[model samples]
Target: LAKTTQPISMDSYEGQEVNITCSHNNIATNDYITWYQQFPSQGPRFIIQGYKTKVTNEVASLFIPADRKSSTLSLPRVSLSDTAVYYCLVGVLSGGAQKLVFGQGTRLTINP
Candidate 1:
């Protein structure tokens, strides 16, 4: 199990790509880093998840270091709607239950 560390706040202009980084120095061997986005008063929405190297999807891309100690979430051409709290977490199975351990989310403010 590992705890993540990320910035508390970030600012970006509309139509610009935004990248947020998370650090997990003591990550386990079989851990997956998952990223989420949550708007105010709304539940978190799954963004992306990865194990090693790079994983890209339609919405975002996840880049992980070889040592699995850190990851970066990249959003291309972000807009105002992308303003939200971004979370980095590690999903693990505990006693037949899946548990998501997350760090303090980073609040991203997208301006026009």
Candidate 2:
């Protein structure tokens, strides 16, 4: 299984864009990479998922390379409300169960 590492924290100003990158050099064949976002007192919400190439939604974009060793999350025009912890996870879904283990995430602080 692949393990991920990211910065412990980051700082950004409101209306600026932010990009958080995670490194996972040993991703497994059955594993699918996913990203999540969590506020102060809330559970992490699914942001995006991708096996390879790019996947984008309203909130973020995920980019994966051919080696699958790393991925990047891009948030455009972030705001103060966007301050939160971002997690990168790798696992497989089985029997309709999504069991994921989250690593120590990147804490993003959006400044005014």
Candidate 3:
């Protein structure tokens, strides 16, 4: 399946909750939704992953509805340091191997 659409850049003040939505209309049943965060001069770091329902981690939470065609990445109480690019990846993992494709991600800028 193709990667989801790239959302527009978002701006938020510190101490706010941010939710970025990703659309994968043709997502396959085997596909899993994964979110990543990237900072300047650094590689993308995994934020959360889910096949359906919801998945939460220390950094972020991923929400996938029953259809699994779209997902949202939720960040709570973001700070200025949270300003970065966020990506939503779709892929199928099998037998310890994964093939994930990414499109242009959303740029989230947290202001003071």
Top-TM-score structure, candidate number? 1
Best by lDDT: 1
lDDT ranking of the models: 1, 3, 2
True-vs-predicted CA distance for residue 85, candidate 3, Å: 0.3
Runs off by more than 4 Å, candidate 1 = 91-99
Task: Give the poorly placed runs of model 2, Cα more than 4 Å off.
Answer: 92-100
User: TM-scores of all models?
Assistant: 0.89, 0.86, 0.87
68-93: candidate 1 lDDT, tens digit per residue: 88899999999999999999997545
Worst 10 residues of 3 by lDDT: 91-100
Candidate 2: tens digits of C-alpha lDDT, residues 2-112: 346899999999888899998876566567889999998899999999999898899888999988888899999999998999999975344555456556799999999
What is candidate 2's CA lDDT for residue 21?
91
Question: What does the lDDT read for residue 61 in candidate 1?
Answer: 99
Q: lDDT (CA) for every model shown?
A: 0.89, 0.84, 0.85
TM-score ranking, best first:
1, 3, 2
Q: Give a tens-digit lDDT track for model 3, residues 1-112.
A: 4557768699999999999999877665687888888999999998888999988988888889998878999999999989999998886444456566675799999999
The alpha-carbon lDDT assigned to residue 45 of candidate 3 equals 91
